[model samples]
Target: MPTSQIAPFRLLRWFAGLSAIVIVLIAWANAWVVSSFLADHLFQREAAVSRDFVQNVLVSDGSINYLTHPDDPELQRSFYKSIEHLSKMHDVLRTNVYGRDKLMLWSTTQSLVGQRFDDNDELVDALQNELVVHAGRITPEIRPKDEYAGLSPRANYFMEIYIPVTLPGTGEVVGVVELYKAPLALTQAVQEGDREVAVAAVVGALALFLSLFWLVRRADRTMREQHTQLLEAETMAAIGELASSVAHNIRNPLASIRSAAELSLESPEDHGAESARDIIGDVDRISARITELLRLSRTGASAIQPTDMVALLQDCVADHQNTFRRRQQELVLDSQVTQAVCTVDAHLLQQVLHSVLANASEAMPDGKRCQIRVSEASRKTVRIEVSDSGAGITPEVLKDVFRPFFTTKPQGLGLGLPLAKRIVEGFGGQMTIDSQPGVGTTVRIDLPKA
Candidate 1:
């Protein structure tokens, strides 16, 4: 069944969209939080300033004289003169001074003076030795068109504070001082701070988003690479099955040909004997090739076992003796470890070593030497090095050496290096090659120690 796939980069696009939404939400939350914090802060600060201002301005000239002589013309004149000017300050919208009995002693509004209001919650709280503060604002959208007609936004913003006035030089309960002010400085400060908090929130969120975006993008790239490798692996597996079947079918006829050649070689007619020997060699080579194909076809199912790598390396060298002699190549084994053990499928490991040896031998068509070395790579790993003293591969060819079906030899199936690499990786090992054009080539494999 065919399945549809989303276009590439869809994940990134989705992430960008989601991040933008998240940042916007963060901005709103920051604005609301900052606004509430600033409001509470301003209330506390303004309450303190109002209580102190009223206390000082009221008693700086005289003390209890006004509280007892509210109707006395002389003291009234003094009290009126002392506080009347404060109400006219730019931010002060109105001011009311209440006596201890809750009678309004003085106010910015002349008519409100001497009036008693018992039901005002803020005023009642103030009379109880507590300060009360309330803030209200009318935006243009909610303004009463006729009542708040000519009011500026600054005028629309107001703070009402009811403070308990304490007697000078003592904590005596005196009266309540109420101030309703526009609080221009506080209003503007809050607006500016809210903006800054929102900006900071967005900047921080974007930084986090970008960091996450980069990591996800890298993961997506890795996933794509793995997907490509999976497709190649599936294709190779299909081809391997077909090649195995062909190799199996050819083995019977190939064996019959080898038996006939062997019988003819015993005829002892010189030329016929020589030809039979050559035919027999060709048949044996073909049989070996078929065996390699069959081995590769059985690849993914290799059984794993704890193996002594030193012994395995020695066996690999011994097994390649016939190929070494036939190809006019010398094989040498060097080990720094007597027994480096690892967990791997023994047959697969042998197949890989054989492939490496054969490639190394074939590199020096005119005859050369190949070396295999086993040593401890680290406390937890064993390293195997296969070096060939043949004219090395070119940089262009070297890069593609492990690609499936890529080879320099006419008869090469091109699966050797790639298969070797796959098998090594399945054994929890890594394989790499280093080649210098005129010097030589070396293949390194590192596996975890058992």
Candidate 2:
């Protein structure tokens, strides 16, 4: 496909990809927050249950004295019985009781008793009378010892909780209780929360994407319609300009021919030949104007040839020398570059040059000087300048000098400069004019070198 046709699709793809990534990131973040909150809630519930069991059942009747003296066979047997019953009821995997020095004083896993856990963050928090919960895979450092290691179906994915044991009435933390349990229920709750968050995010993001896509498509369609209307308007305007130019150019010559015929009819004895010549001249002028219009209407069908610039300019100047003499204008030709050659339609370029010289001469009808300068503008282009010192043009009038059917002179058709500019441009050249109110006007034409 063309790039213009594919650009919008590429843009949409980029927007969709970026939006999808952003939505997924946002959803993942929300899911993580929900899961953390759900997991924490479950862990706190388990910790609370463990705290109640410790306070009401295990240490209710001054069992702390028995825990402090674990060497007593009677107290140890009683403690083991209570722990075993609680473990069976709660489905807890392992339990440990830590004393003030963070040393394990009792455990359902008997082998873990008497071990110290000084560096555990959860143990530290419990010693400060705070409950803490940790979830996820078991680390080698804190895994249970001996046969208790593989007691749960998925022993690795377990919850480790710490609950502080406070003294009744004193509210002082004297010991910490650590509990390990399977996290199957907690995982199910967190997954449910994550699923809810994911659904909400997907729905919201999709709605937003669809809304934006529809708006852009609507705007694109509106722009395309506006563009088509603008092109039609421009085509109509061009046709109007051509019609206006034709009428303006033909009106003057037809009026001149009509006047000559009337004069010849009224006085045929003395002015017969002169009136016939005047009619013929008017007819020729009309024919030339029609030819100019046809040339402007045609596309690039004219053959381009390399022409000697110096010889061409001399011939154009010679043809207009008689008009310059009648106006008493001094015409100066300034050629700086030797062997200046360019590719152009020689006849069309000569006509353009003649029009410019005629305009300059008309601007200075009282015999002021006009200069034509020819030089190499660059290695690839040649420049020609026609400058005249006259009652120069005002900035306001100069602005419309190139508009068709706009004229400063009462009898002017105003097609000369515009047609000249068009002809030059058609040959891959440019024409420009500079004028000052008191300093006169200069027209420059730049054409590519052959």
Candidate 3:
């Protein structure tokens, strides 16, 4: 495919890829933030629940007294029964009571009771009256069974909470309550929230990607159209230069051939004098066509000079008056500007006007009326209109009338209007044509005043 066709798709792909990357980054960041928030929220809720359980249910004046003096079998049995009942109510996998010395005073796992945990950070923090919460792999000694036998395999995923138990009516730290929670519901909620956030992020990213893709595709399409137009303009410019060079090369030979034919026609006694005359006529026509092409190719380098508009128009009309008269057509000149002076290349302007006149004459081959009107179109500009009462150009044909080498007539070279348009534009003027089939055609030229 051409670069023009491929460039847009490449740009679209680049935009899509970049958007996808951005979406992934945004989604990851969103998920991280949401997960962190949910985790903190769930931990805080569990900590609050554990703190209440320790203060209201596990640590009371009687419980603290019984813990201080565990020699009373009835009080110890009551404490154990209370801990066991509370453990069932809450979804607690394991429970441990730690004294001020960081030694396990009692545990639902009776085997761990009386164990000294001097280096335990959770016990140390709890003794300082600070609650500690953590979730991690289960240690072999701390693993729960029996009531939590089904949770043993996932014991590694348990959340352990340590809460301080202060003495009643005093701020003194007495003991600590350690609760290990399964965290199945909390984990499930957090995972569900993460999934929802991921889904939303993906959907939002897809929407944004599609919108950006559409916009990029639209811009790419516009660029491709402009590129194609630029290519066409460049091609036309190259063709104009080529035509100019070819016309220059052919004009000399055409002149030589016409001259030789004219010399042969001068021989009245020559048997083929008529053929010689025909040859001369054909050569002259070819020479005229080549001259038009040469005019189309030339870029006027001369500075614009002030010229009398009325006199210029009159002179151009007079030059073509003989041809119109010979063909029995009427040529009318109408000027509305009082001081008709404009800045233009006189030679180029004359060529444009003469070409317009020839086209008008040809349009009205039946010797109908052709008119030229000059008027002040604006304060700084003048307008000239050449109109003819003849078979007008069709809409389809009119669109390409200014295109070089596009002619309706069989013998027409078709460079006339295009060359005229070029000359007018070179002087910063504009040229336009308006026509309707079977009605008439009008050519308008607007130029700046001197």
- Give a tens-digit lDDT track for model 2, residues 333-390: 8989766888988888987999899889888867689888999989999999999997
TM-score of each: 0.61, 0.48, 0.55
lDDT of 1 at 347: 86
Compose the digit string of candidate 1's lDDT tens values, residues 1-450: 999987666676787788778877876787788778877787689768877877787778773367766778887788777677667666776788888888998897789987999878778888788978888775767566543444456654678889787766677767887887777677777677767877777788778778888988898879987986797688578768867787868888988998998888778576788888888999888887777667667777988889999999999999997888887788889999889999999989998998898788877765788889999999999999999988898999987887777888888878888889888998999999999977899999999998
Worst 10 residues of 2 by lDDT: 147-156
Scored by CA lDDT, what does every candidate get? 0.81, 0.75, 0.79
Q: Which sequence of candidate numbers ranks them by TM-score, best first?
A: 1, 3, 2
Candidate closer to the true structure by lDDT (higher is better), 1 or 3: 1
TM-score of 1: 0.61
Candidate 1 local lDDT, residue 338: 89
Best by lDDT: 1
TM-score of 2: 0.48
Number of the top TM-score candidate: 1
Off by over 4 Å in 3: 1-9, 18-22, 59-75, 136-157, 240-450
Which parts of model 1 are misplaced by more than 4 Å? 1-32, 43-72, 84-240, 256-286, 300-306, 314-334, 361-371, 387-403, 406-410, 433-442
